[model samples]
Target: MLTFSIFAVLIGLLAINVPVVAAIGLTSVIFFALLGQGSFLAMLPHRMYFGTTGFTLLAIPFFILAGNLMNTGGITRRIFRFAGAMVGHIPGGLGQVNIVASVIFSGMSGSAVADAAGLGQIEHKAMVDDGYDPVVSASLVAASSVIGPVIPPSIPFVLYGAITGVSVARLFMAGFLPGIIMSLGMMAALAVLAKRRNYPCSACRTPAREAWASFRGAFWALMAPVIIIGGIMTGFFTPTEASVAVCIYAAILGFAYRDLKLRDLPGILFASLHQSVSLLFIIAAANFFGWLIIHQKIPDKIIAGLVALGASQAHVLLIMMAVVLLLGCFIEGNAIFLITLPIFMPVAKIFGIDLINFGVVMTLLIMIGNLTPPVGMCLFAVDSYAKVGILPLSREVLPYLAVIFAVTLLIAFVPGIALFLPRLVMGGM
Candidate 1:
């Protein structure tokens, strides 16, 4: 009961629009007082500092910088153009292009907001100019952006692995098949919608020269994910090292493409800094909060309660997913992982669930929240990029959202959908 009440208080603080840092830190402080452990207050400062000192966490800022750099540079446009040449001949022309572009960008950015806001402006204008509905364009972009974190080189996977001690390499490999499933699923749905809505399609194949030109144009930009993931898989770089390398690579591409100027770098650096600071602060505060939760053995009590309900491994997972899905709608995605994983992990152990599969499924569920209502970040990004109303985008996004959620649940139950590649290459299940 005390454990659950801490959730209520923390959530209540968040619901009232408290800063995440303050809300989490305050929750920990308040709980310590209530528990009559006033001395814990003295430990808060050190604990917060301690949490931020991990070397692995250096990946977060560099990845954010890489995403912002790619978004600002010419890379997004080239990637989109490459995707269009490959897939624009499909029914619903640019809709398929949109998904393909997002899939490719996902491998690099690993962030839904970057995909929506970066490629979004170009995708919307192309689709709308080519006579697609604003609602459809906005919604498709929002739905497809969910793929950003599910693919390799995912930032969310990094956060998950960091929090849970799972192998980040395995997590990256785990994303391959699930990412393909998401792409094929959305593209299939777009095909049906194209026919039903009579979306324009290119009547002839893209010229061989044009296709080759696009692939060549995007070759370096495309190589970002390949180099990063390849380096990690081959043990040449840790995830943190990969982030720094990608940042340098992204800057080179920016300059080489001639779209980014020396003067523009300050703005990109400031944006990345601002974003990274807020994220890292939440991580620190949440770490302090989580330490208190563990110290209190709240997870144990929660696990006992669930077991008392006779929940099996699958049932506990389903219950946790439902909780995460609900929480994702209200909270930021990484914060959702930071807050919930401490509780859910112990429950997972008691139920004999595998951590890698759990990481993949949990990351998917959190990203899905970015496509949902009210606070869905990608929805807002798409709306701002296209000026389409959120309500309509929300409605049109339903089919893709439903399909991906079902696919996520499918992965959760099967495990092999995610674990297969990791097992095949890394030799562990």
Candidate 2:
């Protein structure tokens, strides 16, 4: 009953537009008070600190800084131009470029909002200028932005690693194939839609020289992922070290490209700092809430209830996928991950689920949430950046959402879709 009441308060607070951290914190406090464990409030600060203090968590800020520097240093534009040269003559033209660019930017950013807000501006403008409706342009940007977290160097993957003690390297490898599948799926969907709608293709195939030049211009930006992944896989650096390395690499490229200056450093640092603080706070608050859930044996109850219902592994996974997707429409992806992962991880293990595959599917579903309506971060980011209204943008995003759902289910049913690369690279699941 206490658990139910706490959840009720959480839902009510979210509905009223309360900040996620505050809502989670408030709910946890009230739950403890109602249970006569008011002394738990004294430990709140320690929980928050412990939650955010993991060495893995250090990578969060460095990656954020690296992504911001890359964006400010003209990395996104070079990647955009290169993608356009490579795919601009395809059926969807600029829409294809949007997906391709997002796939590449995902390497650097590891954030859907960064891809949506940063590369999104470039992609949305190009599409609109080429006669696409503003809504469609924004919709495509939001959809493709989901690719950001599924690729290597993902922030959510990092968080999952920190929380579950899962190998982040394996998680990184697991995302590779699934991310490619999603990218291709979106492009395929775009092609069909483009052909149906008579969307314009590029005026001409990009000349070989132009394509080479674009790639050359984006060379440093292009290598960010390779170096980060390679360094981690080869034991040259930890994920945290790789993040710092990427930060330095990005700063060097920023100066070399002349896109980011000394004056820009303060702004970039402040922006990264602001983002990092917001994310860390959510982790802290959710940690407190998660502690209460664990203390109350919530996951055990859930596992027991599922088993009592004779739920099979597939049934559990599908139900979880649906619940996470619905939750995503209401809460930010990171918050969902932090709040629900503790509750679900134990049940997942009982069903003999592979955490690597589970993490990929979970991350993808939560990312799709970002593209969803109401509180979707990516949706709002694109809308704010592109002035694409919510209703029209949501309507246009449906087909892409379907494509993602299809790919997600494919991955869920065939765990190999996510695990093959990780098994091959790491030599085990």
Q: Pick the candidate with the highest lDDT.
A: 2
Model 1, 254-345: lDDT tens digits are: 99999989999999999999988988899889898889989999899988888788988878888899999998787888889889888888
Q: Using TM-score as the measure, which candidate wins?
A: 2
Per-residue lDDT tens digits for candidate 2, residues 1-429, read 655677789989999999999999999998899889999999999999999999999999998998888889888899999999999999999999999999998887788888888889999999999999899899999999999999988999999999899999899889989999999999999999999999988878999999999989988889999999999888899888888999999999989999889999999999999999999999999999999999999989888889999999999999889889988989998999998898889999999899989999999899889878798898888888788689899899999999888989999999987888877877855
Where does model 2 exceed 4 Å of error? none
Every model's TM-score: 0.97, 0.98
Q: Return the TM-score for candidate 1, rounded to 2 decimals.
A: 0.97
> CA lDDT, every prediction?
0.88, 0.91
Q: Whole-model lDDT for model 2 versus the true structure? A: 0.91
lDDT of 2 at 279: 97
